[model samples]
Target: MSRTPNPTRTLASQTLFRGLDVVDAVADGCQSVQEIADRTGVAFSTTHRLASALVQARYLQFEPRRGYRLGTRLLELGFAAYRDSDIARSARQNIEQLAGETRDTVHLAMLDGDEIIYLDKIDAQRPIGVNSRIGGRKPVCCTGVGKALILDEGEASWRTRYQYDAERGNIHLPLETWLAGMHAYAQGGYAFDLEENAPGIRCVAVPIRDASGKTVAAVSVTGTTDSTDEARLRSLIPTVRGAAQAISAKLGGTLG
Candidate 1:
């Protein structure tokens, strides 16, 4: 009852592959009009047009002298893809387990440009904390779950992947603070939200891996600062971690 895809046809209009190529070309220090054209083997005029369009769409940046590079638009697109992906459905059980185990709000989030998109959530029974819901967005630089998922790629790589764009003139938390959190996340199995996204809501999170063993999502439990005490959070870690691992397994992850 199924069919195999035609490889050639699939590759031509493959948004994933094309998007990856665009991202890679820009990341590899490709600068300006000619550089991207030369690298992509796209005609100069066509490349110019594409670049202009991408810049307008926020997928590519055009500097006065430096030329084109990947833009925050990619993040927006990436987040949307991840949030709507099968991985999100695969992680539902994990979200439920985390919520039940911790008796707190549980959330599943996927990375967007420099933020995290809440694909799903299990609200707390106690109703003692923030009323986060599905489709909520939070800064990746500050949230516990977002930082932990980002840590799966190593500090340097995560920094590169989620680098802030000065062109947008959008600044929130300091880079140094974020870097410190990244270091902490690398050392710790789970990351802490620490009232970063909200003043009274605290959260703890673990990473969710996909079939290729890539951290594609983050599962987290959130509660009020008063309830997320050190002991309670510590007790909830293993439960959260186990749930994340189970979801990762469903996604075909082979976590090391």
Candidate 2:
């Protein structure tokens, strides 16, 4: 009987595997091309070519004396991966807990450029829930979690975003009024929707930070105006904030 070719090995790209080996060698402290070649068992010329390509693409950095080291591009990609993985892993329990406690919809989201992307969403047990999913995207100008994600930004940025949204008809609130609300939200360390994003939906949200004290994500409890009035939404601040802080703490962050 003939042996079936293993697809994993047969379909693998040798060059790609060699490049990864080069990266792994450098990660394991092999600085020189000769050292990397020895560590990866690849030919010296191939290793040198791979290293040069890596340096040009910023996967590795070269120094005259220090040799090669991991580059800023790797750091950026690593942090983004870490942020996403850590937030999802650390926020799952807290998100579930928040949903259970409030009996309302819960959302965990992160800012992506000028938009907010939902990383996770736990729908309420009730018949009506917030119209959001794990990967839904929303404008950063009009949602509670969106505002919470930008709590650290300056007034000028706030005005620019608000004006841009207003011009596009995504928002109708005057710039000054939105700015005033944002100021209060920043001071209080939380934000509210007040039906800004949708007709009757209200939400209370708080920022989740990382060890560097930067807001990497946000958490929110959402409900309809019938179930969550302004007073009730305000009341959920502490509950929502507690969940955000719990996730932040797991991420080595502090929240006040």
Candidate 3:
């Protein structure tokens, strides 16, 4: 079910993701209508309509003789996004410094509905392939950077958004139980990913707030739990917060 989302994404961004499912299915070579429907869980008519919409938007092209091909709009939009994104421009230097200072992977992310998208990343001295890349998306509830980004939304929105976890097999938790932990994290001004998203990988994150106290972004330090102990990870909270605060300040954020 859909939930109230942040201003960064349209309320219908969830639906857009579903539409993107069709786009992804086609990209994966699901050529026929039936194949696309079977892959997308959308009805046959809906699939056809979505394809038509995409064709109209120039995100997809129909081949009367062939099947389908991606349109140039996707590439154009991708390039335009990278070029116009100000977060990476503002935060990349600070992220690099954080990585150098901590020797841990550092990331900058922005919330996109119930997911967070990586806007930039800086690898540490010891590279750990976290299966994450620029433009990659991860679930909000299970990620440190994600929780940090939403910390300001408080318990009610958290409850609504955290009702289901698709990647975690739709696991459900009591609202009170989850909110207690989230409130504590908010009070402390940071969050932790304790192997919640990916096994053996832990992360510490802090919210990047704008001048209006809105959490516009988040920054995180990530490392393997084996290499980064609880104490060491906790110690990184200050560094992560500093980096995030610096970026927020660069974006005209003023701590009230």
Candidate 2 lDDT (Cα, 0 to 1)? 0.89
Q: Candidate 1 — which pairs collide?
A: 32-67, 211-252
Predictions in order: lDDT: 0.74, 0.89, 0.83
TM-score winner between candidates 1 and 2 = 2
Best by lDDT: 2
Residue-wise lDDT of candidate 1 within 188-215, one digit each (tens)?
7688877777788888898887777677
Model 3, runs deviating above 4 Å: 1-21, 27-33, 40-73, 166-177
Candidate 1 residue 22 Cα shift, in angstroms, is 25
lDDT of 3 by residue, 118-231 (tens): 988888789686878888788888888888888888888887778755435532445576678799998999998877788899999998877777888899999997789789
Global fold similarity of model 3 (TM-score): 0.77
Best by TM-score: 3
Candidates' TM-scores?
0.61, 0.67, 0.77
Model 2 agreement with the true structure over 178-246: per-residue lDDT tens digits? 999999999999999989999989999999999999999999999998899999988898899899899
- Candidate with the larger lDDT of 1 and 2: 2
Model 1 segments more than 4 A misplaced: 1-84, 157-177
